[model samples]
Target chain A: MSELHLEISKVGIDFPTPKGPFCALQDVNLKISKGEFVSLIGHSGCGKSTVLNIVAGLYQATTGGVMLNGREVNEPGPERAVVFQNHSLLPWLTAYQNIELGVKRVFRGKKTKAEMREWIEHNLELVHMTHAMHKRPDEISGGMKQRVGIARALAMEPEILLMDEPFGALDALTRAHLQDSLMEIQTALGNTVIMITHDVDEAVLLSDRIVMMTNGPSATVGEILDVKLARPRNRLELADDPEYNGYRTAVLRFLYEKQKKVEPIAPKRAEKAAEKDSSKQVA
Target chain B: MSESTTVIPTVSSAKAASKFPTALVSKISPAKLRDIVLGTCLPILGLVFFLLFWHVGAQHIKTSLGTFPGPKEVVTQWNNLVAEQKDEYAREAAFYERQEKRNAEALKEDPNAEIKVREYNGRPTFFNKIQTSLFTVLSGFILATVIAIPMGIVIGLSQSLYRAFNPVIQIFKPVSPLAWLPLITLVVSSVYVSEDPMFSKSFIISMLTVTLCSMWPTMINTAVGVAGVSKDLINVSRVLRLDWLTHVRKIVIPSSIPMMFTGLRLSLGIAWMVLIAAEMLAQNPGLGKFVWDEFQNGSSDSLGRICVAVLTIGVIGFGLDRTLLAIQGYVNWDKSAVVR
Candidate 1:
């Protein structure tokens, strides 16, 4: 394997609730190498976003911590750029200006005025959003706005990109288009990325490794699958490939047959129901 | 023979239509015509009907001075006020010219003569009173905005500060301008003593009263606006690790602008209303005072002039609100969003 770039060790977080402390995650551990694309996939409420948030330094883990390039991650920084679900583009700023904001923040004393402008234009070109560069977020379509969001995160030249369901709000076609763009960009840049997603196909299509999480009330990594697909993958050709189908079935079996989703009944009610079943068996 | 005659008439009609630009007529669909009638024509018609009602109603109600002034009499009074303002300007110009001539003559006669140029102490015309009221109201509004917006931002950003200040804001919000006028008057009279006072006591009193009564809406609305910034944007700020001032400037101010403008418009409306009331009660030299003085004059023309002032006040208030609305629309980035 390559050099260890990021590490999540003994991570757990307990949120204070009216019912006392509720553990959302516990003993979650993962090690990622440089230039690796990792996807965290699980059922809803599985604390997949929680793990990404912890890595992004937006949330502090109660037990352990996240390390980036051998430094403890405590607070958010421009080096760890996040592409949020809703695009999170400032409505008041144009697409180009939104990218400019992060670029200016990251490249302020390092890049000259013309260099920054060229860099901003290049990132927009990378996402194929140079045409709508001057349009505000409200004026653009949802998919276009998400493209700008990606461009903004890319323009920062971050060490690691964090995406929390970046395409969840988009239509299926738009999602596919964005996924293709993301793959192209990732291949070209070789940037480290950690994305949270619910779509199994999306996880398999993009990730170097998929980290499947268990259902929460203390959710942790259930399994990790390494995809050894060749680079420069074509989704159409891979659809008919036997190896691709094998990997897809493996993930499906793990999600449905092995770690099946259960209805979250209250603890006391579950206990009482279990007692009734055992008593009936005794009778 | 009948078909040939009908074709000839149609050709002539077509020629006529081509000469007159028939595209405009063709463009007005039934819906477009209805919009024109409802949007433009109906408002004009309503105003005409209102004038007619007032003209008829004025003759039947006899007031203490005389019959209430009708539209015709109000128009005459408006013209008279304009002429009076012109005369006042001419007098002011003549006063300055005479002072210059006298000073030059004295300097020529005694090479070191001390000459004094006196200010024109003429009675303020109707237009002058309008200017005074505008100036006072604007000054009060600006003063309030400068103090309220920053304070509101701070209070909104902090939970404990909001808790501490909320009761005080609520208590003072509803206090009337009239209630504050006497206290403001007394305070200005005592605290503002000087050898040559920069502002009149009545002006200060009216302005302070306007400020006190009008500032609450802006402060409260701004606080609400600042507190209600969307969580997604806040997360973006956190992820960016924006500094405190940068966060406030980039995220807080832009998102809260629409609500802040709403507060500003409301405050301005209240400020205008409070200034007039304060001016009237305090006998300050403004349109309010003019109306009060005309009522006390008990002359036949006085009622008509008072009617003119009333109309002018309503028009000015409407104009001020429209101006603020235009400004709000300009500053707001979401052009598709209707500001009102």
Candidate 2:
């Protein structure tokens, strides 16, 4: 566990806009050991997901680069599997076929067809999605679709897993359920993972290290808080625990007090925020 | 939640709970009664109204040949046409039997005698003309699909190639089959040379004209579909490290099938229309030709026969469209797609 499994050294990404080149992220540095779970949390448009995409090799970094297991990632490969924010499973394929597509392509030389089927079932079982393996994405709910997305990513036996807001679109109870299952799956598999999220509780509950990002147009890592909570932590216990509250408070402070100045793009949102600030002062 | 209002299940459970609504509907006799009445009675009433108006209008109309044929006259002509086809078949069978008997007799009397079978040359019936028209249109449609689909895929995948061919497509798309018929006829006549041709020249002319006019819709639709593939799906393909062939096969084709089928349906419509026009103008042996001949015949029953041909053409066009829609429903993975 002491050895680094993945490194993002001073990576920067720039997208061309009509006016000029917009720098979404700059000089972002992250390092993870073999079994670490890290979360990048910030406001929307903070380039947290941009950083994850760079690490996944889906987008090329303008300056620095990502290295996985001592190899520079120049292109996306099955070894670095990604669970996209929208659960990007092909709508035409059932859940089983979607995961099997990636597994068959990546592990063709090493495993027989029957073994691959067993591996796919095993991953689905990990995400508690074995019951709905034959359902198409359209036929299932948003949470089930995201679970299948995770199953597909893990079925490849990837060296590193990248997930972008996997449960951000679900309801509160379902999100919590998925988060718990995710933690259980992570503990059993022990794969290095980097997830992007904006939720504070999700960051604290699932990550070993929460890497807080500053807001963009030039976003970078602002703080790294190490989570020392014991393994297999209970959510209900942590909700009332003083030590967990301290960790939660620290993340909230970084997001609210330290980085409270939100640049609203829409006038309606800006008006609403102003009203919210006045209400808070009144309370 | 209120007592009367049921709690909405979560999304995952929603799938398992989908059957509840249908089950509830089935249990309600009034709901089922309303469904049947609305579905069946309304369309039948509209059709009946159309026939009544058509019959009334036909009585007042007068033409150079005679009074325009009404529904009753069209039925009479249809029966006459069916009887003519049966009589023609009997004549053909008798002619073949007589030829065989004479050839056998000649061979028995003289062992070295030559035996030659001549074809029966009876006028094609209305049903035979319909068969010819159907055969010609399907062949043209299949040929267009074979060429247009591959070409559309290539052009869609390459931006530079799309730009190069876009102007040509825009220019040629509006040209009618009538405008190309003369040029195609001349070219086919000068180019296609065989001592024993497999197809008649007039048939070739009609088929080629249908192919030319109908291929555009499919090509344009396919190009648009390929270009419009969702960005998230492309990202998924990249993440899985799918090769070019696999990406196209698994992702591009399935994703674009709905749009591709839409194009094919439009092309089929155009093919059917163009084949009828080509058959009429080129004097080919089909329904269009049958109508043209009836117009020239100018007998007392000529207008009624033309009415029968027109009705048959409309019925056949509707059947073809329904067939294509059935195929689209079966092949598309999205089972919830409403074909109508």
Candidate 3:
């Protein structure tokens, strides 16, 4: 097997809050193999987005490191392209122009205007967004805008694509539709992908492997499940499948287990506190 | 998903259907008539009530000016002005004809005559006042726009300078145009230094005052607009490695235009208001000056002519606002960019 295309090592992130430090993620380590689809699933605010942003170089790791194809990640570079949850498109640009801007920037000096247009058209068509090429962000539906964002990201032909809950803001039906479209596109292109999602069903359906994070303030990798589902999964058909239930149950259990511990009012292990007090008294 | 994704292709179709709003409105079996009536009733009712009160004020309650002429009086004054305009036209024709005959003989002797013909149409017609006011308003507006937009962009782009200049702007923004008129008059008298004595002092005063008053809103709005562009868009510029000029062209200006237009609209409305007030105080030959002149003359139905001036002001103001709005809609191109 080819070496992993993107590796995140010993990563931890702390954010400043008014009251105190907020530990969003802790001791996070992962490697995404070439041509593999990896989905990081956790409860909302499990710092899944923080981890994705770190990989995208939008945010830096406090202590650990991010490496892409054996190079150290310093800041945002064209090798990693991100599609944000909100589409993050320039509201002023047409879909065609937005994609063209991405392609022209990444493939600078390699393509002419006609060639760039062809590249934009190819990716737009891949996401079935050819008709919306001339449409502005506001002129299109939320789903359509997300498709344009996806097209723009894919059009860049980056080494690893980092999606920060790309479909989290959509309706269930639109989410499912985009999931299918994403699967189709991923199969054709086969680039390394690290997607951040809170939806368990989304994780099961889209990923070769799911990296589930424990809930914060010091979140860790709770479980990593291998989804052995076959290719070209029908979203509706797979949801009803017995095997789908097995994967869903496993993720659900891990989430609920840490969710019980990770809440603010939850009782801690009584012995640990008692032991801490006794040790303090002896000291 | 029942091909909900197909909606992306027909966005323009949706937009076109949305333009009328009555069709899909009915398709949804909406209570659209109720909505239209509900939406329109208040403004319509407000207009009716306004006219009614105004009618009563002009007909019954005699102000210090004596029975402020109602809408009927206004129509009459308008017609009288129209007749006076026609009579003036005849007089102008006679003056031109007499002068042309004299010039023709002179020109027959010297074909390349450098003759400056003057027809002194004293109490030059009401139309002339409108033309004067329009020219002053247009000239001031163009000059303000030429200076304001680039300045606004520059101030808006920089954080520290924006903070530094804000205090001075705040100090001056609310100061009345009337206050600036005396100062501008003094400056222009000394510094303008043009020997064109035929150039009306009132015209220069109104223009200078309008330029000062109207330029602020555009500056403030453009700056705020540029500053308010999404951080995400800024990050995109960084990643794309676009230079400073590209960043401004592709990101900043387009995002700021709607706000800039809002400023322009506001500035224009203020400019007209200021120009009128300046004219009123200074006896500039515009609508406001016309009103002041009539008030001073106190002619029979002088107040009626004042009403005429007021009505003309409202109509002209409305026309100017709509024209700016039309230009805004034209340049925006992306219909979604409109505020409402």
Candidate 4:
């Protein structure tokens, strides 16, 4: 791998609660290379979003920090554009205007007005949202809005794209469509991306490396699986490919068996269940 | 011949039956008919019923002036006021014409005489009072909007500021224009001394009273709206690294617009109401003064004229609210979302 593009070192965060500080993440570490696509996969409430937020510079890690190209990441900047799960496009602005907003901010003095317009149009075209660029977020479909959100982040020409479940809110068909488009865009731009997802197939399909996380109160990196898939991967062909299935099975085992999630039970219920199991064993 | 007659009757009856149902159904669907009835017809019917009740009830309530003026009497008085306004306009025109003639003659004689123009000193008509009330209320409302919106935004952004100013706002919000009127009058009379005053003392007093009372709703609502901006949007701003001014202009203002407008609408309504009350209490030149003068006059026409003023006030208030609502609808970008 080339020089590390982004490094998250021993990151830990404790959120203040009524019962004192609750540790959400501990000793979380990852090093992502330039143009590498990294996926953080975990069960619900495994602090996947927390890690993403810390990297995005939205939440500061109490013990350690994130570094981008040798610079310590403290506050959010346009260079680390985030594609939020909810799309987060200002409802008042049209899709084109939403992209224009970030484009203008990042390239205010660097790019001329005509150049900026072309760049925004280009980003919208990348997401296949050229037709509905004039429409507001409320007027567009959920998937289309997500496309606009991606376009907005891409318009900034950021070094890293932080997406927190970019296609999580979309329907299955739409999700597949978006995933295809995302892979195409990532291949073209070669932008380093860190995506947090719950879908096992999504992680396996898009990620260069899948970083599975353990469950929290102190969620940390459990294992890292590097997929040596060829360029321009096809979902249909991959279904029958043994290598793809092998990778998919590996991730499934890691999620289901290695870190099998136990349903949270009340202390009294757990004690009763323990007693029942012990009594069964004696019988 | 009997078979032909019977067939003709049956065919004609069938034709009539088909025509009646189709014509009614084509003209209005059940949903549309319901909307029309509920939206337009019902309101008009309610108004007509109210008018009838008022007209009948007014007859039994005899006052010193005579039987309390009914709808007919109010209409008559309204026409009388309109005629009086027309007469006043004619008198003003004559005054200006006479002055022009005098100036022309003097200039012709002296060849270098300066034309002296004077304002017409005629008594203001009912229409003039209405104009004065509108002008004063708008001035006060506009001033309140300018001060409150920015102040509200600032207070909303800072927790300390909001906490510090909330008490002051709460205390002042519930204050009556009547209570503020005397203090405003005293302050204006003492402090606003000038040889050539731009605005009348009464106008300033009434305006100040309106401003004091009407500004609270806009301020509080703007604060609430600004504070209530979605957390996700704020994060978007942060990620963009937007400067403070840009953050406010792009995210805060746009998101809080609906609430700010809500505040503005409330403030405008309060301003209008406060202006009238202040005008009545301070004897300022407005519709409120017109109503008060009619009440004091206690002539046979007095009660009827007062009724006319009451109806005019209600109509004007309704018109102002509708105007604000229209503006809100135009500016609000979320077309799918219901405004009202």
TM-score, chain B only, every model?
0.90, 0.88, 0.83, 0.90
Write model 3 residue lDDT over B53-167, tens digit each, in one string.
Answer: 9888657777776776888888899999999999988888888998888898889989998676986565766778888888888788878888888888888888777898888
lDDT of 2 by residue, A126-228 (tens): 9988899999999999999999999999999999999999888899999999999999989998988899888999999999999999877678999999999
Sort the candidates on lDDT, descending order: 4, 1, 2, 3
lDDT of 1: 0.88
Residue A78 in candidate 2, Cα distance off native in Å: 1.1
Off by over 4 Å in 4: A265-283, B1-27, B102-115
Give the range where candidate 3 chain B is weakest over 10 consecutive residues by summed lDDT.
B1-10
What tens digits encode model 4's per-residue C-alpha lDDT throughout B1-340? Answer: 2333343447676456545544545467779979977999888999999999999999999888899988999999999999999999999999999999999999999988888999999998999999999999999999899999999999988768999999999999999888888888999999999999999988999999989999999999999999888878988998998889999999999899999999999999999989888999878899999989988888899999988988999999999999998899988877665776
lDDT (CA) per prediction: 0.88, 0.87, 0.81, 0.89
3 against 4, candidate with superior lDDT? 4
Candidate 4 B-chain TM-score = 0.90
Candidate 3, backbone clash total: 0
Clashes of each: 0, 0, 0, 0
TM-score per candidate: 0.89, 0.89, 0.81, 0.92
Comparing 2 with 3 on DockQ, the higher-scoring candidate is 2
Model 2 clashing residue pairs (backbone): none
DockQ, candidate 3, comes to 0.19
TM-score, chain A, candidate 1:
0.93
Q: What is the Cα-based lDDT of residue A145 in candidate 2?
A: 95
* Number of the top-ranking candidate, with TM-score as the measure: 4
lDDT of 3 at A36: 89
Best by DockQ: 4
Candidate 1 lDDT over residue span A1-283, tens digit each: 4999999999998765445566778999999999999999888777888788789877778899999999999888878999999999999999998888888788989999999999999999999999999999989999999999999999999999999999999999999999999999999999999999988888889999999998877889999999889878888888998988888888888889887987666743433343334323221
